[model samples]
Target: MIVAILGAGPAGMSCANACLSFGLKPVVIERGDHLGGAQRSNFHPNLWMLGFPGETGEQMTTRLAAHYRELPVTTHYRAEVTRVAASGDGFLLTLAGAEGVRTLSVQAIVLATGTRPRATPALERFAAECPRAIIGPLSDSIRDDIRDTDVLILGGGDNALDHALFLAERGNRAVVCTRARFSARKPFIATCRARGDIELREHCARPELGHGNERVTAAWANEQRAFDWLLVMYGYLPNTDVLAAFDPAIRPALSAGGYLHVDAWQRSGVPGIYAAGDITDTPQPSVPTAMAQGLTAARAAERDLVKS
Candidate 1:
């Protein structure tokens, strides 16, 4: 049976691998020039470490792509699936690519479109004027050029603390502005406080950008003040556009935040549709969780297909 996978990231690749192992034909479509989804190099530098020191995101994606190449799945890079519709006991997917639009009829569909970083309202405003204003996931924009600049980070989460520590280690004056009355985690807060180069400001809003025709010059939190680069560590939002063509019964199962609702088997409300990775309503959106979900989805799909 032909199975269409909506992404070529870790989750999609994992699902495709499982499908191929089950003797099913798999088609992997990716919107970007390469796979890895958000794990691409454009994200924050400190990410992909999984709190351990090892391979980078780019390295991991490269390995994933290499592994997939050895599999029987057909991968279409820079291909975007614009529409999905039920057709003749199967499904039809209309894809737009660099060459032209193509259509694929598959028996099963896997939604693994992944997610995009959610920018804070404060940071969005800052970015509107100052081109240098950067967000956590997009931290690579300033990674190489952050040597001597004073960096202002907003949020007290792990992402915020990590970026602050990274900037401090790079010899830049790093300060964290948190809305929480206290740091979210004591250990992280303590470690950041212990770093003389990193300053912590609690119960604060994003500072106002100093007026300049170029980058941000200064920031103000209430009466406190600071300067230079601004990085906001907020989070992410799932990309569910690929599932838009699904029936309404399937759509409502998605969480308020747009994450697909899935059972332990990763089956959504639709019988032949499955979801995996950060696009699900799973409590944890980690890489391991995505991989496990992908495996489960593929196995469930195989089982269901056999029973039918």
Candidate 2:
């Protein structure tokens, strides 16, 4: 049986691996040329693969890419999925990309499109004008050029704190503006709090960014803070727009956060459709967890295909 996997990231690659192991054909499609989505840019070292240490995220992703290449999986790179429509027995995917528009039919499709950094409404107006100042998760496109700069970060979650710590360690002064208490774990919070270089501006409100000299300037509380860069560490959101054309029943399978709601077997409420990775409403969002979910989805697909 053919299993169509949207995304060739860690989760999608793991799903393809599992499918091959179960004697099934897997097709992996990625919007980007690289297999790793955010993992490739991750600065952290060592992933959850037994006792192997000192391995960077990029290294681990490269290893996974090598493993995937050795498999019999058919991969389509630079393919942008336009929409998904329900077919007679399964689904039809419409893609418009480097290869032009094409439609593919499959019995089951795994939604592992993953998640991207969410933009905050407060600085929405300034983002388009000062694109270089805004830093999003999975995107390190402008980091190297802005080293040792003062950045004002907005948010109080795990992502916010992580960026704050990273910037501080990289010789940049980062001020985190958050009206609410930190949503990150105690360990991360403590590590960030312990840093003297990183300043946490609790109870900050209406933090905004202004564009001048082709860069971002800080504007908050009737005063403009002197900062060379602005880094907003808000959280992420799933890329579920491709499913907008899906049946009405499919919409309810997604959670409020736009993540697909799946069961233990990674089966969405909609039949012949499964979701894994950061796109799913999993309690924890990490590479190891995403890989496990991918494996589960593949096994579930095998079982359901046999039953049918």
How far out, in Å, is residue 83 in model 2?
A: 4.0
Tens digits of per-residue lDDT for model 1, 19-126: 988878888888887777767663333333365446666666677778878887788888887777777767778888885998899888888988876686766776
Q: Give the per-residue lDDT of model 2 (tens digit) for 1-308.
A: 78899998878999999998887788888988888776887766654666558787777888888888998888889997777777777778787788889988887888888987777665555666676567475255665566787778888897788877877878988888888787777897888888888888777884555667655666676777767777666788897876775657644367886688999999987877888899988898888888999999999998898576
Best by TM-score: 2
Structure candidate 1, residue pairs in collision: none
lDDT, model 2, position 289: 88
**lDDT at 222, model 1:** 37
Identify the candidate with maximal lDDT: 2
TM-score of 2: 0.91
